[model samples]
Target: MQSHARGHLVYAASGVLAVHTERGTSIVPANRVAWTPAGFTHYHRAHGDTDMRIVFLAPSIARLIPEHPAVFLASGLAREVLLALTGPRNHDPAAPDYSRSARSRLLRVLVDELREAHEQPLHLPEPRDDRLQAIARMLHERPADNATLAELGKTIGASTRTLSRLFRNELGMTFYEWRTQLRIYHALVLLADGHDTTQTAYACGWANPSSFIAAFTNIVGTTPGRYRTSRRTTARASQLPTVLKSPD
Candidate 1:
């Protein structure tokens, strides 16, 4: 993980990106954009054959954005603007170019678009307590585990009530709530890897496809089927390996 001198915006033109920082994790699918303010140590993991693009923001524009990392829904206009700014034309000397003034105007519009857009609940906050850390590690390894908080506590040496209070006080959510979020995060990665809904449901601990659909739609703002279809063009197995050359 590293930080930049200037804040920047990253867009996954295809596939998905997850931004990790000390605070938590933020999932950035194709329909969203992520902004990381200057000097926040973080790293990004590309999921599938991601075509990620980035645009650095000037300090003036950066201050208008949140100081911490955040995810925002990318409107059609916002997507177009981001592509235009980061597209090959900017690097290809023979291609048509944008003047400095024109670029500045585009940056202003981009920041304005984000301001008008609402923040997404895609972040899963990190916990600090040792007991909480132990619990998190176990579940991270087995999201499909259907064990209740009480059942999980038995293995971790903490009482159910203590664990419940820790989740609330330290993470600001209940055990089930955090697990649901964790499951959804894993579900996205699974889908990116070409898993069908039925497969993803069982793999992520959902009893059946229907239940998984309801929870996925409620959190991701779209059905798993639709999300899968949208990613089909970008994540073909044949082209996924190139992403490893540079995981940024």
Candidate 2:
């Protein structure tokens, strides 16, 4: 989880993975992958039985990706390339020269695939100021806390104006916007943990399920029900037997 000299791509063939870095935190589901540039201090946590795969990139290749941590949609080709690189068949130290050449080609393909993929809006930027951090910690611990920004500011010994400016200048988002993003992040985790929409809505501070669905869909690009269903489907598929003989 510590910073490395080489950048790496993290993907989960199933389940969810959260990557926390100085720049932000990325929530990566089965269909997405996260890229951490070299020399970034980061850590990861898996939400379920994750089939995690990682590929380290040389400085030259890593430069092609973003300087900051990012999340991208894992395309079909990208997934295949990742599996090939991390699969046991590709790990022989004494493999023939041709095998090495094949691996090199696959690595290039993987980088190219990532370069062309669209980035996902799965990142949650962290606050830097001490007061903002205090407010963030409180909300993170209790996502359902519906305190107004003015109310939260008073508790943190900062006026509403100061807090608003800090949120805009430091986080590049309004306080409300930041809170909504945080709530959505928590809602994603809860949903992945098998909480239904109504339960997730209340847990994340949404007064109504409809409002939660709207916000979740806006940020995650899918409704809560669909997202949860997709995760379950992927889990089931991963658990299926590799070979099934057809009846004669």
Candidate 3:
């Protein structure tokens, strides 16, 4: 993981990007934008064919956003602004170089749009307790694991009640909720990798595709089939500090 002096927003033009931090993990799919605040230690992993775009925010602008990492719905206007500020369209033969003042104005607009956009629940908060960590590792390694909290606790040498309390205190969610999110994250990667809905459903531990479909749509706002076939909108790169480096 690496820390940056400037806060940055990343957009996945296609595929999915997972932003891992000490706090937990944030999933960035095509329709969402992810923010990592300045000085946060983070690393990224790309799933499938990804066209990840990144824009760094200046302190003046960064202060307007939440101090913690966040995932926001990328509204139509926000998406366009991001693309105009960073995509190939950012350059113009008529304008030659896009001026700093103009780009800054665009960024202000982008921030305004983002402020109006709903923050999403794409974050999976990390667990710090030893028992919770053990449980988390177990689920992460095999999202297909259908073990109950009691069963998981048994393996970790923790009581189900104790583990339940720890999950609430440390991760701010129930075991089932956390597991569902973890499975969704994995399902997204599988789908991006060209796995069909049925395959992904089972791979992520769903007993049936219908169940997986419901859970996926609840979080992602779309069915897996449609989501896989959807086209990517143009957006993301920087140096006003709107630089586009190789995603890795």
lDDT values, one for every candidate: 0.83, 0.82, 0.84
Mind giving the per-residue lDDT tens digits that candidate 3 earns over 152-185? Answer: 9889898999998988888888889999999999
TM-score of each: 0.91, 0.88, 0.91
Q: Which ten-residue region of model 1 has the weakest summed lDDT?
A: 238-247
Model 1 Cα lDDT, one tens digit per residue, 16-86: 78999888888888668998888889999988767777788878779998998899988878877887887
For residues 20-86, write the lDDT of model 2, one tens digit per residue.
9998788887768899888899999888666677878878767888988899988889987776666
State model 1's lDDT. Answer: 0.83
State how far residue 161 of model 2 sits from its true place (Å): 1.5
For model 3, the stretches where C-alpha displacement exceeds 4 angstroms are 89-95, 231-248
Task: Let me know the TM-score candidate 1 reaches against the reference structure.
Answer: 0.91
Least accurate 10 contiguous residues by lDDT in model 2: 239-248
lDDT at residue 106 of model 1 (Cα atoms): 94
- Candidate 2 vs candidate 3: the TM-score winner is 3
Query: What's the C-alpha lDDT at position 158 in model 2?
Result: 94
lDDT of 2 at 180: 91
Give the TM-score (vs. native) of candidate 2: 0.88
